[model samples]
Target: MALNPNVPANQEQRTDEIDLFELFSGLWAQKWLIVGCSALALLVATAYAFLATPYYEVHSILRTTQLKELDELNGTGVYKIDPEEALRRVGASLDSYETRVSFFNANRELFEPLKKGSGSLENAFAAFNEEQFTLLQPDPRKTSLVPFVGLKLEYPADVDGVAILNGMVRQAISDEKVRIAQDLEGVIKSRLNVINRQLTAARAKYEASKENKIAGLKEGDEIKRAQLQDELKALRGELRLRRQSRITQLDEAIAIARSLGIVKPTTPTSMGQDAGAAQGNIIRTEVFNQQFPLYFMGSEALEAERNGLLKRRSDDHTEPRIAKIQHELQLLENNRQIQFMQSREDEDLFLAALADLREESSRLENIKLDLSQLQLARVDRPAIEPIKPIKPIKMTIMALGVVLGGMLGVFAALLRVILRRKANALA
Candidate 1:
């Protein structure tokens, strides 16, 4: 029983070997079919390679502008746009779909090929962005390399991609320049408005201050004049009372003198002695502890003094302070400082900051830069016509076709062998 088990194993191994041999022999018989299919596929691929539409790729590179190139723009105080920012703006404009559409619409003749077979202008342009136009930039992960942005356009041999790329770049630069100029103008206008407002306020403040000063001066003058008038009135009243008291004392003393029969002025010693006994016309005065009465003078003299006091026209002339007050009031009638300020034709002279504001405004107003000369971005490399088509490679397509054809032929050969085996078993 053991010897019989080893013999069955040997027979199964021999059957597997025979089956492998038959499979190889069947595939070898179908070698011509595989070769024929491969040849047919290669021919079709060759024909397609020569007949298919070839697209050419054109590229233009843009770099940041040089510092010296933007000197005028940077020098302008109102607005400053740097080279990197300018380059970024241009790149943004180039990357915009709207910008691409605008360029396409403007140069319809140049883009006539894109419109072909496309449903509408929108669809054609949309397809154009997806297939033909490409926005390129340096790798962000690589920091050591100089940053640059590029525009790539792939077009058929019938279209001119070079002209389109160059035109777009120039248009983007021109648009950015216009935007910078407008921004500068807007800033200058806003600053000018602020300066004008400040100047107006300063003038108003100056005029108001001048009027206030004039009013204060007038008020001060009135107060001073009033004080002088009060002092002068009090002095005049005191003088009038003193003069009236003297007149009353003189009247009483005159009656006393008339009762004593003393007509001329006499001293107390004379009143005791006889006036007729007096030698010569020389008058004798005695020093006494008491003050001499006003009646010491003759009646005629006292009457003359009283009459002069009553007939006096003005007391202001007698007081020095009254004359000084009148002089000060006359000066206040026309203040030189107030007149100078009021008559000033140029108020900016007094306002030191106004001149500076005006100068700044004038500088901004006179700002003139040749925007056409400004360079928004530098064209590192201009677009050039492609030397070769970037389409379906003939060699690659033919190779793939050969491989696929061989695969199909082998499957057909296997299926035929299996069907023959089943038919044989049925028969």
Candidate 2:
């Protein structure tokens, strides 16, 4: 079979190859140009290394010992003045890039005056305008104020520039911490005072209501007069005395008859059995029974009434009265009970008040304990602490010089080639 003429170009053998030796020989023809470029690059790199300014960095470490915890059940976490992954969240916000920015902005005016004094005002402002002296720090979301910050100050190193940078950071951090401490302390004291005053007032009101309920119970009722006592049955000895009163009444009646010349008392039953006599006897008996008792009772009652009554009453005796005065007494008793309940409620309220007061007292006591612990944590805050040290860096100034010098050498060689080509064409 014939080889397929339609086979892809990849199957065919390639003719071109990179001639490394020939290329090297061609470059050697311009060896002096390459050497000059290399020499220029070395000189430029050395000058740049010597001329660059050195930067000094000073840092400070800050942490919040009183960082708030979300769970109240996790008691004394803040008191421990300890850090955790949770504490790191607020720690990140405490001050990160923001603190550095504020520090530079606040001292901007101060920097200008110093620069003018050092005769570098024009140069300093020039650098500032060019965005060379920009202050930078890790974003707050990513940074923890724990161990430390790599605080930095980049200025043309000379005279007191380094000293001022160091001083500025130290003074700023110290002032910020003092202000924070005083603010936190004041907040605790203020809340404690308010709670104590409320507790005292509530306690006093509760106590007074309890005492008044006890004193009002002993005084009895005042509803009826003494005359109303007659409706009740007389006592046993009293009924016996009434029988004796009937005998005395009989004796007196006989005396009256004797004084009228009849010695014996009239017999109401002695009348004959004939209709008129029977009727008269029945009438006399009825009269005797009814009149004798009425006369006897009327005489005694009249005598007593005359002696004791200031004026005769209307004699309308029945007033719908309370038998035991039980409901009225019950009402008064209910009033007493209500007062008792009020007193009990006062006691209960005071108990509740005491519970609340105890809670507040316990809370304050815990805060006081926490404050004591925090004071120590504050002391351990590092001064001008460093998290990472900056090392001397090699600049790419030499690399740029080498590249640019080589480009110039190639351009000169290209000109020489073009001139030779033109002269050969002319010949």
Candidate 3:
């Protein structure tokens, strides 16, 4: 041990080389075992590649609907659905578990493979949905890309994947159409109900106003008639009093004319009644004036007026206001405005905007939307039958098997060599 301090560096290098050579010799001795393991692994990989069930992948691309395809829906103005929204709805349906289950149930013949397992049909479908179905969409951050949504499905080669994917897309479009149509119908019905209620209210209001107007007319007519009757009665009473008074004045004038022995209208001078001048009485009083009393108009004229007044049967024609009152009362017998309102047959005419509303409703009712050919989303690429299986890549599996066999062979060889040396040293 003390003499090892003087050993050259070259000697240590030779010792390391010998140890590496021994390691190579030990691996060469178990070459047959390593070959056997590699061959066995390669056999298993080849068998699996040929016997395993091959899976096929099918994909479809969906784009937003075009504006021209949605003309009928957008033209209505009352209800509208956008292209982006329609595409989004289809994508959502594709991602829905319920939608997938419904499709599965409706077309059970297509999903027969999922029923082969020991688990229930629902569990199989859940597994299939989780593993086999994929939803693809453009990344929001990728601005240069045209936005699109797609469905990817990987299924056993025996299944008709193309039919399944295309059918599902068609079903989603049909369902969206139905939903839009129902929404439109519901809105129209609600609007129609509101319009009908408004019409009823308008009719009721018109009837109330008509009744109020009729009542007011009747009241006014009664008041005017009563006032006219009162005025007529007052005029008649005044006429009667004037006639009686004239008769009394005529009687007095007659008495005075008879007592003076006057028979006709005459001046006092003409009758020589100026006694102050006839008796030569210069200082005697003399009355000089033109107008005289009603009696002075002469007893013959007064008696004639008194007899005419007494003979009068009515004084209605004497007052001009009485004739006017009677005419107004006749006019009030029936109000023309109220009559016009009551005699009308159509209550709808009372509502100002009723005609316009009816026209709008009729237009909406007549609206013809042909959704049989409505396109909710555009199919950029339809699913096609795949020619090759995407799983169990044969060349890659075989290569991995060779590498794994080599590793396992080397580990066994090293362990055997170490164990054999220890046993030899013990002996």
- Model 1: runs farther than 4 Å from truth? 1-18, 269-276, 279-291, 343-346
Q: Highest lDDT among the candidates is held by which one?
A: 3
Q: For residues 35-60, what per-residue lDDT tens digits would candidate 2 score against the true structure?
A: 69776876776576556654434433
Candidate 1 structure quality by residue, lDDT tens digits, 1-427: 2334535777545543436667778878888887887888888888888888888888999998898888888787777777888888889988877677777778878777667663776677687778888898878777735567889988877778889888877776777777778888899899989989999999899778778987887688778767767776787787677767866777787777667666677677776766477767776767899976766766666667767767877666666776776776677667687678778897778885787888898898899988999888889999987788887677888898898888878887877766776565345
Query: What is the lDDT for 128 in model 3?
Result: 85
Clashing pairs in 3: none
Which should have the higher TM-score, number 1 or number 3?
A: 1
Q: Rate the local accuracy (lDDT) of all candidates.
A: 0.78, 0.46, 0.79
Clashes of each: 0, 0, 0
lDDT of 2 at 359: 78
Instruction: Name the runs in model 2 displaced over 4 angstroms.
Output: 1-30, 56-82, 85-98, 101-156, 159-292, 296-355, 358-404
Q: Cα RMSD (Å) between model 3 and the true structure?
A: 6.4
Instruction: Give the TM-scores of the predictions, in the order they appear.
Output: 0.87, 0.45, 0.83
lDDT of 1 at 269: 78
Highest-scoring model, TM-score: 1
Q: Model 3: per-residue lDDT, tens digit, 1-427?
A: 2224555667645543436667678889999888888888888888888888888899999998788898888888778778888788888888877778778889878777677747777787778889999998887777735567899999987788899998887777677777788888888788878878887787788788888988988888889889978887887898788778778988898777667666677556545756454455334444876555555556677777778878889877887987887888788787798788889998787778789878877877887787878898999999998888898788888888888888888888877877775565345
